[model samples]
Target: MAGLAAAALLGTAFASTDGLARTGIFGSPGLTENDTSEWLNTGAPDFREVVESLRPSDLPLPAGRSWQPVIDQQVADGQREPARMQATGVHAAFAHYAVCVWDGEWLAARQAGDTARVGRAVEVIRGVPSWPIFVENDGGGTVDWLRSIAEAATHGDEGPIRQHIRANCTSSWIGVDQ
Candidate 1:
């Protein structure tokens, strides 16, 4: 009975919503170093610069609201096929950066006991489809670590949450290894 209950919980946790699978739990196949190098050769932006530019307020929410509409609009504009081909690597790097920001926000909110901010941060995290892709693209084990941070935040466990961020968030940006 305990095993069955655990399985049910896992199912619910991993289930896809709106056709998008929840990320950070299961490890997807990672990209090879060669693949990353080739992608970078396509003129990707500097990973550090991209990471530095990201702010938590730049993420969009479900209710037609965003902290920075102009930045979001720029992202939206890059979704075209031509732009996508050129900027795929850059976008992936940004995804990793976003996760790091969200993880920090979640931790801060948890420490402050700010439930509203916590929920908002988690919502932004859930909306990011890049986590899974990051894992799939050989980003790093930090992808799973980020998921663990999310789970810890949900359970109000600050210890592990802080530990994971300290251990993984600093170097979590995709393409950083390259």
Candidate 2:
């Protein structure tokens, strides 16, 4: 049931982004089957799912593009409908891991005192869509945490945020490797 719901939501999402022809397994435009698997398995979100979660068919954030506004808007909007953010492994789970890996990179760069990489990581992390995380529960708090953690990456540490993401997101539905 969860997988079917995910498929339906993805079908609508794909159609909204492009057309019916794009609705397929790992058919989120630039994201290939191999790319999706590699990214999810490694916890590293590529250009597609990280920033382009809502519109996978579109290009990723270009150089110098800031994800602050998008993040702000998502946090404000709070959680979406269950059908819209189906709690499937491919979806909520994949998105969760992508965020974890992206933030993990930021925390690592901060620990290593790599200012440049830390800055770059922050930019990337800001784009992660929070809708999937909402699938784990409800309220704008989930979204707010994502934004706050992105900010924390800039000025403080995010080890605790990682624990929250992991404890909340353990991969359950479709599209997950486990």
Candidate 3:
């Protein structure tokens, strides 16, 4: 079960990168290491920059919707192509944050005395990404890392488990977890 959860999280991470690579914006042929440095200068690298480059800058949404919802709704509404949605600058950060949120929510479910909900979140989190490097490709063994955290949560060390997850996921798109 723990292995499944880690795999799901990692899978989401890689799928996000695959989305960007297919978008033709971030990983353009000429993107040197220096170019990556420049792109990092864009301040708060949300996926909206990719959307702004690909489509009209004036798409309507509520004031505080996350990038995933915007992109997901766009796909659901047939307003944009899957490729466009994947290409959003928000993909990488969103995926990273999603895993963090998934861990926190799952830990909460388990802590709040809802073991069933914890299992469900675990199932979905497993399904989403599989492992962390599937999203970022740091080393490998992210599955083992996730398993350790899950074990911690199962032991009622919810706070530390969440803190560990958040530390692994401090990215530019979403702010650090508070």
Candidate 4:
């Protein structure tokens, strides 16, 4: 999966100038040239900025409804495009952070036992442009890995997630076990 170009995925667009996959925003510290020992040791980087960006500035969840409406409005308004994602190291962070925020919403709903909210979150995520990048090959089509991952995370089960990380890991600097 390393060095995959935008063309590798049908209709997918990569912002990389070299037409190669670049690391950052997607928890690919191992794929980076930075100090591996130092970087990996710090664990996952703080993504508060990306999470905060998804918050509605002037809109709050109305009454008993979920935040999906606001997120949907943002999407329809073209405000949640990939170019609007966290850009600490990416030119456009939408592709990366959209997954993060959606995963968070999914997990939160699952944990709260809110089946309706979980379904709504999943529906919202279905519209995210970058979601296709998270799919993995299966027999007939592809697996929506993010949904499985969110399920795993909500259950505090890292085995499946680790298997995915190792199987798809393209970085040599940091060990998948790390």
Predicted model with the maximum TM-score: 1
Clashing pairs in 4: 82-94, 85-93, 85-94
Expressed as tens digits, the lDDT of each residue in 1-178 for candidate 2 is: 2232233234121112322222233424254221232111111222223323543222233333334444332322222311122223234433544565555556556677888877877776665534443434332355666677766666666665555445543332111221
> What's the residue-level lDDT of 125 in candidate 1?
63
Top model by lDDT, which number? 3
- Which pairs clash (backbone N, Cα, C closer than 3 Å) in model 1? 30-138, 31-137, 31-138
Q: Please give, for residues 27-129, the per-residue lDDT of candidate 4 as tens digits.
A: 3344532112111111112223333344533222212434443234324332222222222222112333334444454556666788787776556544442
Q: Order the candidates by lDDT, highest first.
A: 3, 1, 2, 4
Mark the regions of model 1 whose C-alpha exceeds 4 Å error after superposition: 1-89, 126-132, 138-143, 170-178
- The 10-residue segment of model 2 with minimum total lDDT is 38-47
Q: Report how far residue 7 has shifted in candidate 3, in Å.
A: 21
| Per-residue C-alpha lDDT of model 3 across residues 90-113, encoded as one tens digit per residue | 333344445565665665566577
Provide TM-scores for the models: 0.43, 0.41, 0.43, 0.29
Kindly indicate the candidate among 2 and 3 with the higher TM-score. Answer: 3
Cα displacement (angstroms), candidate 1, residue 92, comes to 3.7
Query: Which segments of model 2 are wrong by more than 4 Å?
Result: 1-89, 129-140, 165-178
**All candidates in order of TM-score, best leading:** 1, 3, 2, 4
lDDT of 3 at 79: 24
Superposed by TM-score, candidate 2 places the C-alpha of residue 130 at a distance from the truth, in angstroms, of: 5.9
lDDT values, one for every candidate = 0.41, 0.41, 0.42, 0.36
Model 2, TM vs. native: 0.41
